[model samples]
Target: MKFAVFFLATFLVASQCHGGSFRSFPLEMPTGYGDGVSHDDVRCASWRLAVEAQNIFGFETIPEQCVDSTAAYIEGGQYQSDSKTVNQQVFFYASDLKIQDNDVVIFNVDGTVLSNIPYYSQHGYGSEKFNSTRYDEEFVNKGDAPALPETLKNYNKLLGLGVKIIFLTGRLTDKKAVTEANLRKAGFHTWEKLILKEPSNGQNTLEYKSTERGKLVQQGYRIIANVADQWSSLKGGNQGLRSFKLPNPLYFIE
Candidate 1:
């Protein structure tokens, strides 16, 4: 993703015009992970809790078909969108947030990073289909390269630290299972959360996850931090949520 000042300006202006609302309130990253008794340590506990929740109940394991489909889209070509400028900006912004193994990133499909899903959708691929079917043995057996290998590896380290790993995305249901499978095959040893887009019945998957997380938080699990390249993740007024703002290199959402 390439960065352009013009696109950034446009994104800000467009967001204002659209009256977009984000929930996350940014907090400074603690100097370091401190002892569990310190204030920073409490924050770390919260973050760790969020990560663990993702590992335990995020989504089912990913299937091989999703992995192949994702790879095919990347190897094929990018599909152009009307908001080309902002998409490019988000891509570039997200790149700066990439800290090579230190940061735990929840990449936004529509904003932080663009996936092959769009390309496949445009090309009449089977990715648009969904059913009760989840990731299966057939999909796993025919796998190629994982869809997001590097991202998965970075999260894996967090898992090794006893920190929970998650992949919080707003992907369509059809692609959600496959994406999870790809991460699993790529050596992400933890069961990552796959946040899917809401269905036509007016369900908000993110909201549900947020509610579920609140329960965890009340149970004494605090979210240490969450990093994303887009404003979408911060739709509420919660200040304890930690976020890293980076330019969106890929022009995704307007």
Candidate 2:
């Protein structure tokens, strides 16, 4: 009887250590196919990164990557291409703009979602006009766009906690001023890194970003997490980066 009791106690302790609470969540990509983003869902890639960082390291919140027209636009409605495997027409229509001043919308299109046609809509800087050359500027700015208040709030909280914050994106780099104005309008402030895409440096764009993330890792700055709409970005990041994603129905190009 005594031996059995002791073994039972040991088993219970071991079980707890290996259970959900004891282990990290299985590394899975964010769900793409959904009715759309729900306020309470809290499952976007960016949000996932933030949550993981908070849980693992004592970080405050997750950072975000905001793409702009220059990055999405390929040739002024000529069909902007993404680095993801899927081919998509990315556009952000003004009609899709906020009907209410504070109205917010979340896009989610992945599995079982529509396969073809443009995914997102935009104003003047349509995906058609997207040019990779614009990112030549060292400092890329972010612009104000409709965003989830929750995301901004969490990012702010993280910053307030003394965590160094940075921004990364495949957006064109030259339009830093416009991007900055947009981000401010969207309620973001004082970001550290605003990484943007540059002309292909002989390597595939996907490989380039992956290499960069590795370099950042070697710099001794522990990457707590990464959030993005695409899988390539998630895969390219450091092993320590907790990845989170949101709904991105559009296609991914590289």
Candidate 3:
């Protein structure tokens, strides 16, 4: 006779994008822990939690290592949305982990993600598909949107603190000039860098953002925070020190 044993586990990755970028060090699972338990199972569990973090709280990635007797801990609404407040903490059981905070932070340009756009109407708010014509129209009209008051205040405050800021967006790179104009028009005065997606890039948000962030790191920049509305903008490598998310239930990308 064979018996099955279920195991609960948590793992962490450094520098994941959660509405903002933050560093999350990985934890090693103990050896000879459970029967029939594979490393992939642990990773899958972690990935599921990461996905939930993004779906529910707009976290680009899980900020901390979490483990529980069952996966229900996360499913039970124990972790709230990150957008509700800046200082809220998510609870998780894990061995031992350490996080390092960086000084530079990255922001997504989409008003739904980071900056608030009071004048910009959320046209694709209820769209089912992300690559639809309506989405394209929305992006084109983003220039007409004005920045949100709270977001502008935070941007200015971070800037005043001498924290280097980078603007990363999935907008077509061809619209670089126009995007810059729109940002300035919307009161975004200064930034260390502005990254836009290229037409030929052929990479999803996760791949594109991760690759770009890696490039920045290679260039000697430390990414401490990442702010975005979409999960794609947050996942992947070179995540950073912390991540902050904005509410966007309109559409989701695989």
Candidate 4:
């Protein structure tokens, strides 16, 4: 610290003697930064990794500094690249599975197969608080969310390989029509099952999804793989033979 101060002082004194302007440098890093960029971006990148690994939990919104960084990651192709890498690994695993008439690949709707980028981008890229009502009315009900390109490719490949697809979504039963319509519109043309949550059932994602997938197992369906963006949707009893978690730096649900 002393050496840095002395060097800076000497630099300023030399500049003055030479009649040259000294460039400004802050002694301390600022908390906030320009145009949403910040040191927190570096920190938030690690934070996001933790979030993906399920080390971070119950985050209702993203860190304020990460809004821009997360947005850039989503819009600037990194998200797709990351998805491609995960999906490639998924294909390798799914391709090796022995063929069985009862085998099925279970998928989550929101962030796994389809993207809500339009909705999230509008909602501060997860910097803002989550509003279920607003999200449902303004975004989900429209039934036009686009398919994530990489997951869509994986879906097609799995389908062509004779692996049955099952959509197990947290979307409410009331949304069945719009969600189903949206699935078709988003290129998920066929699936063995499109299970939606009943609004009256008051279970959290882990419990609800576990119960649902467990029921499938009871009915003699061999779960080939389970795929979702949230760890809560992936972990739990009857979590399939394997699980693929896609990246989601947005909101975290319990």
Candidate 5:
């Protein structure tokens, strides 16, 4: 009886440490899939695992990649390769075993979630005639811009996970106070840092944001994820392990 009790206790501890059963799908690309697989392929693979997880464990989790796909087939399950063999294998493990919420995430300010679309529209700055100074002034003055629903949801999720949030914006440092207020009003309660562009810094948006991220790394922050709307906000050195680009059709920044 004592041995039985000890074995049960050990099993329970192992299960708790592993965070239940979660299968990891193989990341290996098929031979004909080319030297580099597309992002869709990776996402599809993830979705496949999510589907299996739902089926086996009754978890309702869905992969973010299939959120917009029209085909229910792809959304439902991963398609088998032409070779009649499953290209991916799922491995069960703990979710937080690798990178937990304690890791850091870098987010871009403007188009990412601040929802500057309406503001830009009200100011008459279309995609063609975007003036940075005018937009910045209006944005700072308004201080009540709405947040993007999808991105905002993801942001809140990250916060719930205990991830450190850092804002790296192209906005001028002078507007820091207003930006902070705006973020707070928009329900972003806490963050590690809110970095803005120095007025004297002549670097472009890409360069400036990249340098800021590098600074975070120098300060001993492990950036596990980067979320932004513009590619410029993501390109450059000190990039995180994973990047998620939100859609931005308003204006392009170099």
Candidate 6:
């Protein structure tokens, strides 16, 4: 019985280390898509890497054949494990920085600082076409977004190191209220600024982000790190000192 109790304690500690706050695994280690990986698993894994590397652009839907395999990858806890690895690198970068008074971390809201998994899980983990209206109503407008556990940890660590947090998202200007509420509900209590898209802007996300970040630079805020899941959100002029991309297999933008 004591051995059993000790085993449970070890698992809990390991879970905390793996950014496994959102999942509970019955196995000592994540099985990673059952016993053996199939052809579909290999295909989906490669596609997911391509998605992360921006090799594929403007992908509106995940491939139908890869949907089930993708689901297993996410639900089986490998998603969090992969995320933890990325954040571990990010944390290392942040740890070595010499923060200044105006130094800031740029955080893209959705799929970066926030997790929309609850909404996506019902939609086949992003295999379905993205319906902007439905997504806004059910996910955005409701102030129901949850924090990405890995990000929240690094965010606080950066804060403790004296760097200010600035949230820069592609969400529109009109969502200010619920966006603030959702951010707070998701455990982000403060930020230096919450920059959002202007409804009338004609530029794409990359252009929009570049323009906004330029303004911040002119105003004397030095971007320490620009963190986001979307490459568009991380690229362009005034890009910052360094950029870190988080793992997101759900969908691609720009």
Best by lDDT: 4
**Overall local distance difference test of candidate 6:** 0.79
Tell me the spans in candidate 3 whose CA falls farther than 4 Å from its real position.
1-84, 87-102, 112-124, 127-132, 138-142
Please provide, for model 4 over 48-105, each residue's C-alpha lDDT reduced to its tens digit, 9 standing for 90 to 100: 7766875566666666767888988899999999999989888899888886998899
Alpha-carbon TM-score of each model against the true structure: 0.41, 0.44, 0.58, 0.85, 0.60, 0.84
Tens-digit lDDT string for candidate 5 (121-167): 46332313555567666766679887755556666766656677888
In candidate 5, which residue pairs clash?
Answer: 22-92, 23-91, 24-91
TM-score of 2: 0.44
What CA RMSD would candidate 3 show?
A: 12.7
Model 1 lDDT tens row, 1-254:
95332101010111221223212122344343333434333332332233222221222222223344333333453222223333334334444443333223344433233233333344333323332233223232233334333344434444544454445555556566565665555565454345565555353434544553454456444444444434445343331235443332221221
Evaluate candidate 4 by giving its C-alpha RMSD to the native, one decimal: 12.0
lDDT of each: 0.38, 0.38, 0.56, 0.82, 0.58, 0.79
Given candidate 3, what's the lDDT at residue 34?
A: 54
Candidate 2 positional error at 12, Å: 43
Distance from true position, residue 75, model 6, in Å?
Answer: 1.8
> How displaced is residue 93 in candidate 4, in Å?
0.4
- Alpha carbon lDDT of residue 232, candidate 6? 83
Query: For each candidate, how many residue pairs have backbone atoms clashing (under 3 Å)?
Result: 38, 41, 21, 0, 3, 0
Higher-scoring candidate on lDDT, 1 or 6: 6
The digit string of per-residue lDDT tens for model 6 on 1-254 reads: 33221112011111212112222223232335344756566656766776686554556667677789888887789888887887778778878987789999899998888898888899989878788899999999999888988888888877888889999988889999999999998899989999988899988888899999999999999998899888888989999989998888888666
RMSD of each: 17.6, 18.5, 12.7, 12.0, 17.5, 10.8
Which model, 3 or 6, shows the larger TM-score?
6
Q: How big is the positional error of residue 181 in model 6, measured in Å on the Cα after superposition?
A: 0.6
What local lDDT does model 4 show for residue 189?
96
Candidate 5 error regions (>4 Å): 1-97, 100-102, 123-128
- Candidate number with the higher TM-score (1 or 5): 5
